[model samples]
Target: MPPAVEARPRDVRGYPVPAITPWEGGEPRFALTDHGRSADCARQRRCSVCDVPMPPGPVWRVVGATESAAIAAALASGEPYRNLAPTTEGPGHRACMLYASMVCPYLARPNARRGSSAERPDELTAHVVRGAVRGELGAVVGFGDFEYAVTETQVLFRFLDLVEYLPHDTADTHLAELRAELGRVR
Candidate 1:
């Protein structure tokens, strides 16, 4: 298989690049995510990046303010919650998610917006845009246990005990470290 993913791959910028992330013309498409693999990761309890079993503890999801708010509102409602739902991007190992949040261009930038429907007219892209919080506020790392909730249309992750939310920062320190590494390599 893909080397068992004991250790995940990293891009030049030192970001944890997901195994299922798309590549086009030999260049990685960092903006796009693979929905099939996302579902698989959630089902198998595997790390989205490395495709390995997650270590014991909470699973980590990179979420924006919109998702955070939806989750909070659903929890506050008190009745059985299902509509709040999950993102197509599945939970991953904490380190993997943290590294990605710190260095991935889209996640690191607080104001980066997705391309419009006119630009990317695909169902998956549409889902991504709909699920994404417009980049007005920064992202957060959410940790919890999740179970699949089957709906009439699709299956989604229903998080349990999702008590932790950490701020996702832009990669100033990581970019500086990358630059230093490049200087040494040269």
Candidate 2:
């Protein structure tokens, strides 16, 4: 007689859950809650940022295809989130906030700074924004579209794309001047 095969448990979605096996180091460590893990799975079931759900079952796409390559390039170069800082009494603030909201759902109101002499950290600082996300994620830094969590040791870059808006008159323009300063820390 042939040996019997074991069955797996299914979740609410009717997907089989593989049997939990002990790791070489011992019990597995999970960083996210059950609900959060479910949400992450759901997000992966669809487009990275879109709401539409993908069809059930296995599907494949070329990782470095045109669209994927574009996204990868954008994320790698930080072009998508650059130059979003606001200027005084202008559309820059609104535009930045709007763009940020698309990536970060909990983005707070814009906080402006005048000079480096300020003691408190600038609220509009991207690092501060990243900190808020880290706090909510229980210190885990997961990076995905519409969500972000990264480790302290990980190199994170907040690109402010102001190249187009920057003035061409001077070699040491305001935007160039600010970027030079920010680049040092990263």
Candidate 3:
């Protein structure tokens, strides 16, 4: 008899695929965001911020201690929450949160001094907002923290889309610290 292989991941139609295995080493794990190896996730990209699948294009990546804190608070509160800027959980429309990433206090951190390494120890380095899709507000993440967001809890947003994918090598405005990290390696 042939050895049975791991069951193929099921396509939930709207849900983004979750990683069955985590990054074992310090390399990097893109699964934390919409960047997964699953066929559905690849076939259609969803906005990490709005949870709305969209045409693969340019999306906004949110960062900074404040945004992080808000996410933590939102999860802990366990209430339908909303923000003017992009959320850490998903991709957002460039037109929706683009201006925020460019001006958010924590994002800019003008007064904050650059760390010695220039590389931030706490991030995937980049998030790409790909193509677009117009779908109903399926569901909102439940309760959780920076580690993870609860699935199917809130009813705030409907509609998600894919904008893009940010490889470890590419750095956007959110990755200001790691902007030229690869260049410095040489």
Find the candidate with the highest TM-score and give its number. 1
Best candidate, lDDT: 1
Q: Estimate each model's TM-score.
A: 0.61, 0.17, 0.23
Q: Give lDDT: candidate 2, residue 177.
A: 37
Pairwise TM-score winner, candidates 2 and 3: 3
Give lDDT tens digits, candidate 1, residues 61-156: 666656656655656786433434454566776555655665555576666655433234444235456334345334444555777743443435
Question: Tens-digit lDDT track for model 3 on 15-55?
Answer: 22223212335332322332242222223454332334545
Q: Cα lDDT of model 1 overall?
A: 0.56
lDDT of 1 at 64: 62
- Indicate the worst ten consecutive residues by lDDT in candidate 2: 135-144
Tell me the whole-model lDDT of each prediction, alpha carbons only: 0.56, 0.25, 0.31
Off by over 4 Å in 2: 1-39, 47-108, 112-186
> Which sequence of candidate numbers ranks them by TM-score, best first?
1, 3, 2
Model 3 TM-score, all chains together:
0.23
Task: Please report the TM-score between candidate 2 and the true structure.
Answer: 0.17
Cα distance off (Å), candidate 2, residue 170: 29
Error of 2 at 114 (Å): 21
